[model samples]
Target: MAGIGFELRKMMRRDTLTGVAKAYLYAGVISSGPLILSIIGMLLIGVLSLGKVIPDFLITQFQVSVTYLIAASLILTGFVQLAFTRFMSDRLFEKRIDLVLPNFNAVVLIATSMSGVIGLVLAFTLFADLSLGYRVLMITGFVILSNIWIAAIVLSSVKEYKHILGTFFIGYTVTVGAALELNRFGLEGLLLGFVIGHFVLLIGLSGLIYRNYPSDRFVSFEVFDKRFAYPSLIFVGFFYNLGVWLDKFMFWFGPGTGQQIIGPLRASAIYDIPVFISYLCVMPGMAAFLVRIEADFVEFYDEFYDAVRSGATLAHIQESRDMMVRTVRAGLYEIMKIQAVVILLIFAFGDWLLDKLGISTLYSPLLRIDVIAASLQVLFLGALNVFFYLDQRKTVFSLSFVFVLLNGVLTALTLHFGPGTYGYGFAGALLLTVIASVYLLDRKFEGLEYETYMLQKS
Candidate 1:
């Protein structure tokens, strides 16, 4: 994202409305494009296969299978995602560019191997009742998707947004197209198409990484060394991703809330659709996040640290810290403002939107609340980004842990309270986390100079 920030800053330097639009547009696409494509592609496959595939339950099964794959892979790989990103950032900072590609290969290999074993065990054991073809495709898709996530962390460092966007477009397009053609064979066919598309996506992203970052060695296990690893970041990544999904998992598996769709998979019809639609609304806020935080906030963040490292005058360093604080506040405010407008629009027409999509308008209330929760999630992410820039791993880990705890307890209470209270738990958890994060950020900035000087290894 910092890499994309440089490109975005270059575009904004043009100092024209068109230039500003282009920068944000690119940021939005690059930040949220793959997710939007995956959501739309899945929905498109479901819709297109409606009549072609027999027995509507098969469609639901396919959707559930893909959903489980995505959720499980993300949570499983969460241990490495942020930790590996931090590793690469440190290496780049130390000008050990060659180490990045090789170490990335090591992480990918490690992640995929572990995911493959877990996926295979689940596919064969848990899905024993399903066709062997379906089980094989499911595990294959899971492995490929896991690898894709690992590749994407490295790809984010590449400046060529257009290529990244193009690769995702082609991959998902092939997914939809191939799924449509393969649906005559039913659920197994659909899973196969998904596996094929994501396999293509993995290769394309890997190619981009290899081209952009050529390493003399093919792979290395140096990232596993104690000096390079941050256990706090590992927990932060895991707990954060786990927190994000915990509420949904509660809904999916809670008593009377969800029905088993497949072997071990359950889904809440009352909860899942609104949550899915609400996530789509995050694109606007995501654009604002990348542009404001990455481009605007990071500029001052770098300046503040640079001033400290260069032993600038106290007054100058204080000025830089003030600017950084101001940017952080403004950036968060801009994200909230942008997301507010989006939420308002959704509130105004949510019933109609649900009606158009053939979902019951009864979903409108849940959708509205889910939108708010999603917006708060964007704010939460913004705050975490700021904390990361300030090197506050302990703060991140604590916030993430609190979110998981709150969401689990509150969401369970909501389940006990009934339908009317649903969605409030996730929203409440984020609201509290964001408030706490903002307070801690302010405190950190207040003592920025003291910490910089006193916290050193010397």
Candidate 2:
């Protein structure tokens, strides 16, 4: 991402008004490219639901089922995602790029086997009422989607932004077109189209990775070895991903908020629309995030650490530290500023936007709250990125745990309180988490010299 940021900055070397606008636009695309595609894909599905050819109710069911597949697959594969990322990153740092492709194969192999088994069992039991073909397609889609996510994570870390964006565009184009054509077969057809599209996506990403890091060996179980794996990372990944979905799940399962959309699956129409829109609105902040933390903050971060390592004069080291601290503060401030503007824009046109989307204005307040929550979510992401740079995984693990616990408990309480209080819980949890993260980051930066120079090597 920093590399992407650097490239964007280079494009804006002129710093003219049009250049600046283009730079920001490019940043937004790079920052939220994959998510933008996903949101568009989902929206396209929603649009198709309104067509007369397929029963709208069945289309709704397909939407809900696909949503469930996405959430479940992400949660189930969360542990492996982070563990493999850490393993491969360590290997790369050690200049053992040879190990990467083999371990990736191992990770994919394990993820497929695990998700395949679980998806089959769940489809058979939970979706028993659905047709046999639909269930099979659902299970296959889930497995493929899970593998795509794992591959996509690694691909994001290594591949260029343009290549990643192109792959998503092609893959989702096929998905939307295929699903539309197959709507005659109803949910089963929609599911099959989704599977085919994702399979194409997986193949494209796998090819990119192979081109970058080709290996003759087809498979390896090296990720299972204790030497490269980190158990703490496994838990961190699981908890972090679980935390992200906890509030949404609570809303979906809550008796008052949730309704059965399909066999043993549920959706919260009122809750989901606002949340998705809010997520879309946060693209600007995400773009700012990549430039601020990934590029500017990282530049100072390396300089500060490098000064220390070189045994530079105390004044030089202090200057570097101050610059690093200032850079961090400035980066966070920029994110807040950008996200603040986004929130205001959303607020100003909330009703009209909802009207344009064919949603009731009654959802305006929820949408506003969700946008604020999503804004804080980006701030939290910036903090987490900083923590990662500092190698503060334990701190990150603690924060993720708190996010999960608070989101679950608070959302449940909000549900108990009634409709008026909805969306506040998710927002409140983010607010609190951001506050704690800022405090910890401040303390860490304050003690940077001691931690870097005085503390024994871990």
Candidate 3:
């Protein structure tokens, strides 16, 4: 992402209003386009299929099914996502680019097989009441989506943001179009359309990977070797992803808050709608994060490391470290400012926006709170990115663990309390987590010089 950020920074150098706007726009699209596209495409399908598809409940069923698929696949693949990212980063740092493609293939293969087995079992057993075609398409969509997540991680390393955005646009366009046409066949048709769209996405992403990083070998398991893999990263990834969705999962399964949607699956419309709507507001924060952290903070981060590696005078290294610290602080402050503006906008027009979407204004309060929570989530992500850059894996693991624990316990308490405190649990958990992360980051930087000099291979 820093590579792409460098390109965006060049755009900002044009020193014109349009140029600056374009840079942020590009960053937003590239950083959040795929997700925004997916959400829009799915919602568009539901909206357009209203009159065309018989039995309106099928649309809800399709939506619920896709939601579960996305949530489940992300959590399932979390085990490998960060570990494999670290492996690729290390291999690239070592100038072993050839290893990237093969290892990517190996990870994709493993993820596909694991998700395939799990998806098949659930689709067949849990969905016994659904039609065979629906079952097949459900599992197929799950597998494709699981692989898509892995593919996305690799594509993030590529600098061709245009191609990445184009692929997602084309893919989701197909999804909305195909789904509209397929609605005549009922739920199975909608699921099949989704499956087809993601299949295209996976193929396009794979092509880009192959074109960029051509490798002699087709697959390799070197990434799984003990020396190359970080077990802490596995837990960090799992806990982080789980924490993000754990509150939602509890809401969906809680006794009174949720109702059965389809075949063992359940949903909390009161909670889910506001949460999803709030997520769309994360684009500004994400763009700021990519620009501030990747472009601005990374410049100083590199200089600090370079000074350390070149055996610069202690004074020079300290100066570089101070500069890095300042950049990090400024970057975080900028991210917060941008997201604060977004939250204010949400507060101003949240009810109007919900009415426009035909959602009850009764959800307005929850939407406002959820937007704040989502904003904090972006801040949390920025902090984690800094930690990852510094290779503070143990610190990151602790933070992630705390996030999962707090989110689960707090959400349960909210459920026990009442409806008035609904979204507070998730919001409070993120607030506390972000606060802890900031404190840890400050302490880490305070001793960074000592850690750099004393903790060394030499």
Best by lDDT: 1
Q: lDDT tens digits, residues 75-140, model 3?
A: 988999999999988887788989999999999999989988997888768788877888888788
- Of the candidates numbered 1 and 2, which has the greater TM-score value? 1
Runs in model 2 deviating more than 4 A are 1-23, 33-36
**lDDT by residue (tens digit), candidate 1, 130-217:** 7889888888888888888888888777888889888998899889988889998999888888888888888899989999888899
Model 2 per-residue lDDT at 318 = 91
lDDT scores in order: 0.89, 0.82, 0.88
Could you give candidate 2's per-residue lDDT for residues 1-458 as a string of tens digits?
Answer: 24465565565566698867766776676677544566678679668746744567887887788888888888889889777877776776687777778888888888889888997888778877778898888888888888888877676455366786788778898888887778788777777777788788889888888887777777777777887767777888788778878989988988889998888888898899999899899888887887777767867887888888788899999999899889888888998998899889888999999999899999999999999999998899889888877878899999999999998888999999988889999999999999999999999999988888778576
TM-score of 3: 0.98
Task: Score every model by TM-score.
Answer: 0.98, 0.94, 0.98
Clash count of each predicted structure: 0, 0, 0
Q: What is the RMSD, in Å, between candidate 2 and the native fold over all Cα?
A: 2.0
Q: Comparing candidate 2 with candidate 3, which one achieves the higher lDDT?
A: 3
On a 0 to 1 TM-score scale, where does candidate 1 land against the true structure? 0.98
